[model samples]
Target: MKHPVTPDGRYFAVRCRLWRMVNPDLDEAERSKLTKRLMVARRAVRDAKAARDPEAEAVAHRAVDVAKRALGERGPVWWKDGSPDLNRRIAKNTPYADWYAQVTRSRHGGS
Candidate 1:
């Protein structure tokens, strides 16, 4: 299937995956916080792409810092990596593992 794209042509699937990795539970508070960071990052990336501006790219870098901090406070292990292999390992062994595994599997149609 063709992936959804933003009006500017950025891939929605990539954005969705990044958003999910940053905040998976759909928690209102968490989503709000990440949304703020993501906005900043998106603006930075957009500006950089438009004008090749290093300063604008820095904003996106800062946004990533904010995201790391937020993700870190929730759990030490959760901040390591957001890849499926790592997430699967954490989910299989941690308290929230079962739910995480189920959700990820269901989303990807994997067993």
Candidate 2:
């Protein structure tokens, strides 16, 4: 849970890639509910893959997508600032590149 977040807080870095943060505007209960749905859908995807059921996997993937979108992690940008969505982009390739470099240098103890 201790991932580096972009300065604007719009995304978090994981494995050096950016993933959009969930909508902070969502009420606590709504966000929790959507998060639960996402967990369930992700589990379904795992099950489908283990069972070698391609059709079921596809369905589960769609469920995951829907849940993510509802949580504002996908689809339309949640922030109204007109900034481009950087979901899934490598941090080093984004405007966050300099910040990311600084963070890595600090964490790894470099000048």
Mark the 10 consecutive residues where model 1 has the least summed lDDT.
Answer: 6-15
Off by over 4 Å in 2: none
Clashes per candidate, residues 3 or more apart or on different chains: 1, 0
List TM-scores for all candidates, in order: 0.40, 0.95
Q: In angstroms, how far off is 67's CA in candidate 1? A: 2.3
lDDT of 1 by residue, 1-111 (tens): 243322222112331331124434347887787778767777777878689888877877777666654744222334335423232223345444455455566668998
How far is 41's C-alpha from truth in model 2 (Å)? Answer: 0.3
C-alpha-based local distance difference test score of model 1: 0.49
Q: Pick the candidate with the highest lDDT.
A: 2
Candidate 1 residue spans exceeding 4 A from truth: 1-20, 23-27, 72-75, 79-111
Query: With candidate 2 superimposed using the best TM-score fit, by how many Å does residue 14's alpha carbon deviate from the native?
Result: 1.2
**What local distance difference test score does each model get?**
0.49, 0.94
Query: What's the CA RMSD of model 2 in angstroms?
Result: 0.9
